[model samples]
Target: MSMIGLVDCNSFYVSCERVFQPRLCGVPVGVMSNNDGCVIALSNELKALGIKMGTPAFTLQPLVRSGQIHLLSSNYELYGDMSQRVQAVLEEFSPTVEPYSIDEMFVRFDGFAHAPLLEHARQLHHKVRRFTGIPVCVGVAPTRTLAKLANRAAKKIPAYQGVCILHAGSAETRNLLQKTELGDVWGVGRRLVERLALMGIKSAWDLAQANPKEIRRRFSVTLERTAQELRGVPCIEMIDLDEARQRIMTSRSFGKLTDDLDEIREATRQYGQRSAEKLRRQNGLAKAVLVFLKTNPHRQDLSQYSPSLVLELPRPTADSREILHAAGLALERIYRKGYLYQKGGVMLLDLIGADRQQLSLLDTPQSDAERQRSQKLMDVMDTLNRRMGRDTVKLGMPTPGAAWHLRCAHRSDRSTTRWDELPKVRAL
Candidate 1:
C-alpha cells in the first residue's frame, strides 16, 4: 500500500526558456554556464543534434555559427522562480512532498486507495504545463529508487507521454528495470558501475536481485539501501524539513584574469556577499570562511599560482558585512599581485540553524534582545528584496563595476517585479 511519486521536469532550464518564448518550441535550444561559457542544459532537439553538456562554447562555436543550435545565458533567477512555482503546485497534490532537486520532487501518495495514480499524475502534469509552459515526467512506484528508473523510462517512451507507473510485481515494472542502464540508476556512479560490472551486475534488474548481504559487505550501507529500494522496499523517506547543508560555497570564473589587489578585494567581497545571502536564506550562520584564488589551470607555461586562506569568525554570523570583512582579510593574505587570477570563491562552513545555535560564553556575545533585533532586521531586508527586485536597497559591497559582476550581455530584466523594466509582449 506504500506509494511514492517522482515528478521530473523535462530539460528544465531549456524548457523554462521555451515557455517564455514560444517561438523557441521545436528548436535546438541550450542554456549556458555563468559566463555563457558552456552548454549546461540542452533541449531534445539539441540533444538529438549531438550537442552534449559541458562542451565549451568556443569548441561548439562552429556548430553555433551554422545555426544548428540556439543558445541562451544561464538565467537562474527565472529558473528559480519557476521551480518554486512547480513546488507550490506539487504541494497541493500530497501532504508530504520532498523537493529532490531544482527540477524534481518526490511525493508520498498514501491513503488514496481508490484514486487512479496515473490519472492523478496526468492531471498534475497538465496543470503545470498549462500554468508554467514546462513539461514534466512523472514516475510512480512502491519505492523511491524504482520511481526514478520509471521516470527515465517515461522520458524515452512517447506512449506514456512523460508518465510511467511501476506497480509492485508487475511485468511492465520488470521490463522497465531491464531497459534502464546500470549507470543511470540512482547511487550507481561511475566508480560503482565499474565495480558492479566486475561482479556481473550489468543491469538495474541484476543489481536489484543481487544479495543484500554481499552488497553491504563489499560496498557500504548506502549501496545496500539502494539495492533494497530497487526491490520495491522504501529506504528513503519523504523529507518534510530541508536537510542541513554540509557546506556552502559561492564561486565564479571572472570575465578576465587580473591580479590587482583592488579588483581582488572587489571580487572577494562579491563572493562573500553571495555566500552571506545563501546563509541568510537558509537561516544559518557560518563559523568559518575559506577564500581561494586561482589562475587559469590550462596555462602551464606560465607559473601557475593558486592559494587559499581559511579564517574563523570571532562569532558565527550571517551578516554580509562581517563575512566580507573576514573574506577580504583572507584574500589579502592569498592574493599574488603579479599573477592573473581567473577564478575565486568563498566557502562558509560549520553551518547550523539560527534557532539552534550554541552560543559561547567565553566569546564576545550579544544579548538575546540584541540578537533577536538583528535577526528581525535581516529578515525584513530579505523579504523586501524578494518582494521587490534584488539589490533594490543596495549593499555597498556589491556596487556596480565591482570586478566580479557576471558578464551578462543579454540579461533579462526583473520584469514581473520591477516597474521600470517590465517586459512587453507583442500581440498578433
Candidate 2:
C-alpha cells in the first residue's frame, strides 16, 4: 500500500503575518484580496467571530474601528518569500514532496512502511515551525483523498496535536470514513452531494461501499476513482512540476472601477510581462494572445461590458514586447467607451516549445545575429531582476502611479525583502 502525507498550513497568509510580529499571535486578523476589497484569509479568532472569507472589507470596517479585528493587505512578495522557506523545510523531510499549492504539499512514501510514520510527521511539524514559524497539519494515509481527510481532522480536532496518521486498510481508517461527510470528501461538489444524498450516500464510508459501476454510469469516472481511493486504494497520482498548462493568464481586479483606457493599457502591460516571463520559464512560446476586460455587472444602472479577444501572432515567441504589442492591439479592437472596467488580463494561448514550431509564411525571418542578441538581452534582464528583486528591471511597464493598481493600504512591511522595512533592534 502506498502511503501519502499531506501538510497544510493553517490560515497561510494570516500565519505569514504573525511570524514576524508575535504581537499578532492569537489576535483576530484577516488578509484582504487584491485592492484590499475582500477578506481572503481569516485567523482562528476571526473565524470564531463569524467573519467569513470573501466578505467585503467595507462591511468589516466597524470591527477594525472597535479594535476587535485587524486587517492586512495581500502582500504576495512577503507571502511568497515565506512559502519558499516552508518548502525548503518540507524538502528536508521528503524527497517526493509535491507542492499542491502555495500552502499545501503532498509527500508520497518511498519506503517508510516499516518506520514510525506518525512520529516522523510530528518531528517534521516541529522542524517547520522552528524554521518558518507557520503551523501546519500533517495527515498520512493510503491515498491522497484519505490524507486530505486526516489533515482536516488533525486541524479541527484538538486531540490530534497537528498530526494524524491512518494506516492503509486499517479499522481506524474505516471508522474515520464513517465520520467524514460526503460533502467533505475530496472531489465531492454541491452537485455531487445532492446526487449522492438522493442515493442515501451521506458519508464517505457509504460512498466507499457503493457500486462502482453504477457511480461511473450515473456520474463521472473521476468520482468512481474517488470511491476507490476512499477504500484505501491509490487513484490520484502526484502532480508533475513541469506539467503543461492549457493556458497561462495573469490578471487582477483594480483598486477601484475606472473607464480610463490608458490605465487599462498599463494593467495589460504588467500582466503581459508576467505571462511572458512564465512562458519563458516553461520553455514554451505562444501562437496566440488573448485580452479580456470585465466591468461590474452588479450595477444595473451603469452600462456593463465584458469583452474578450484572441489574436494570432505573426510568429510564436515568448518575447514580452511582442506579447504586449499583440495584447495592446487586441484591447484597441475590443475596448469601448462609457463602461467602468473593474478587471483585465492577458493570456498566452496555443503554447508550443520553441524547437517545435513552424514559422508563419508572412513572418519576416530573423537573422542569426539578431536572434542571438535578443536572447542575450532577455537573459541579462531576467538575471538582474532575480538578483535584485521582482520587477527590479522593467520592460515599459509603468513604474510610477497608475490608477488601476491594486490597493494594499494596510500592508505589512516586507521585512524579509526590504532593507528599511527590516525589524530594528537596540541594545538594552
Q: What's the residue-level lDDT of 38 in candidate 2?
A: 93
lDDT of 2 by residue, 1-428 (tens): 46788999989999999998898999999999988889999998999999898999999998899999999998998998888888889899888788888999898765665356777889998999998999999998888999999999899888989999887667888888999999999889988999889989999999999999999999999999999999888888866788777689999988788888998999999999899888888878899999999998888888878999999987777878889999999999999988899899999999998778785565454554555676677788788777777787877757355778889889998877775688888999
Per-residue accuracy of model 1 over 188-209 as CA lDDT, tens digit each = 8999999999899989889889
The CA lDDT of each predicted structure is: 0.82, 0.87
Q: In candidate 1, which residue ranges exceed 4 Å CA deviation?
A: 238-241, 356-373, 397-403, 410-421, 426-428
Model 1, position 128: C-alpha lDDT score: 81
Locate the minimum summed-lDDT window of 10 residues in model 2. Answer: 359-368
What TM-score would candidate 2 get against the native? Answer: 0.93
Supply the TM-score for candidate 1: 0.90
Q: What's the count of clashing pairs in each model shown? A: 0, 0
Cα shift from native, residue 401, model 1 (Å): 5.2
Candidate 1, backbone clash total: 0
